[model samples]
Target: MLKILKYSFYEMIRSRWIFIYSGFYLIASMALLLLSNDISKVLISLTNIIIILTPLIGILFGTIYYYNSKEFIQLLMAQALSRWSIFTGMYLGLAAALCISILIGIGIPLIAYGVLGSAELSLFLLLITMACVLSIVFSLMAFLIALKFDDKVKGLSISIFVWLFFAIIYDGIFLLLLLGFKEYPLDKLTISMIVLNPIDLARILILMKLDMSAMMGYTGAVLSKFLGKNIGMIIISFSLLLWVILPLWTIRRVSMKKDF
Candidate 1:
């Protein structure tokens, strides 16, 4: 497993896409820093970008890497490697690679800007944590999704659709439901809906951390009333942790039963 992990990690690190991905974050972070001296505003802007882009890239890269590495996977299987090790190692390798890209891409500029000594440091760390968690959660999901389909085109299509649903459609649908039932109380429903979608969960977590939940309107009030800051943070953190575990566990199960 370790050997497989090392191979996959190094192989991905050598890829030009990883460089481009990391470079994108580095340039974006630098640009944000240059545009605004206000760390809070910059963090918010970054939160928005990371929430959307991280998962997109994570899942896309996972699916593509899965299909691209089929030949290597076959070779590993022929050598009697354990299915769990192969799948899990590959997943970790890909996820770790993405995390590194995120760290490098976002870390350098912030460090250079002396965020480490600033009061906003904790918030910056939280933002990075959420970004990396999203990367792992979505990439693991991509692997599980890819495993279900042998067709690369079909797999890629479903991957994109899954991302779209979670990142965009889910929120739109949630808003429509709220508008349709504006007269009725939706506190419980609103919380449940946000908890169900990882992207929404992440956005709420960051907004709360930013101390901007007042801008969240009724939903924010309900969250604060019901969960409070500490409890809400705990719940959100636990849920995000499950988002990582459940998918990876499913990947292991699926790989064991999969013919490939």
Candidate 2:
């Protein structure tokens, strides 16, 4: 498993797409920080980037890597390599590659700007943690989704659609529900809805650290009451942890039964 992980990680390090992803972050972070000269605003912009782009890239890269490694994986299996090791190694390898890209891409500019010594250091750590977690969560989903559909095109489409649903449609539907049932209480329902979408869960977690005036808003009140400050953050962190575990477990279970 460690050998498989090393091969996959080193292989992806040479991948052009990973370099491109990292470069994109490098250029964007530098521009945002240098141009705006405001760490707070740069962090906010970065949060949006991490929340949106990281998951998209994670899922796409995971699926493509899976298909690309079909022959290699088969060769490994022929040599009696365990299925879980192959899958887990590949997943961790890909996830690690992404984490490195993100860390280097954004870390350099942020540190150069002296984010480490600032009071916003914890917020910076939270942002990076969520970015890594989000990457892992989506990559696992992409792998499991790829396994479910042998057709590459369909697999890719479903992956994008799942991302779109969580990133966009889910929020739209949640808002409509609040508007449609404006007279009724939706405190608990709102919290339940956010849990169903990992993107929203991440946003809420980071926003808690930001402590914006918007935190005094309606949804914030609902979350505050239901999740109870510290407990809420713990639950969100635990939930993100669950998001990573469930899909990998599913992949292992399914791989055992299927002749991959």
Most lDDT-accurate candidate: 1
lDDT of 2 by residue, 151-219 (tens): 899999999998898889999999999999989988878887888678888887777678762656887
Q: Model 1 segments beyond 4 Å from truth?
A: 227-230
Q: Give lDDT: candidate 2, residue 133.
A: 82
- TM-scores for every candidate against the unseen true structure: 0.96, 0.96
Lowest summed lDDT across 10 adjacent residues in model 1 is found at 224-233
Candidate 1 global CA lDDT score: 0.90
Per-candidate Cα lDDT values, in order, are: 0.90, 0.87
Off-target runs (Cα >4 Å) in candidate 2 are: 213-216, 225-228
- Per residue, candidate 1 scores C-alpha lDDT tens digits across 71-102 of 88999999877888888788778988999999
Query: What are the clashing pairs of model 1?
Result: none
**Steric clash pairs (candidate 2):** none
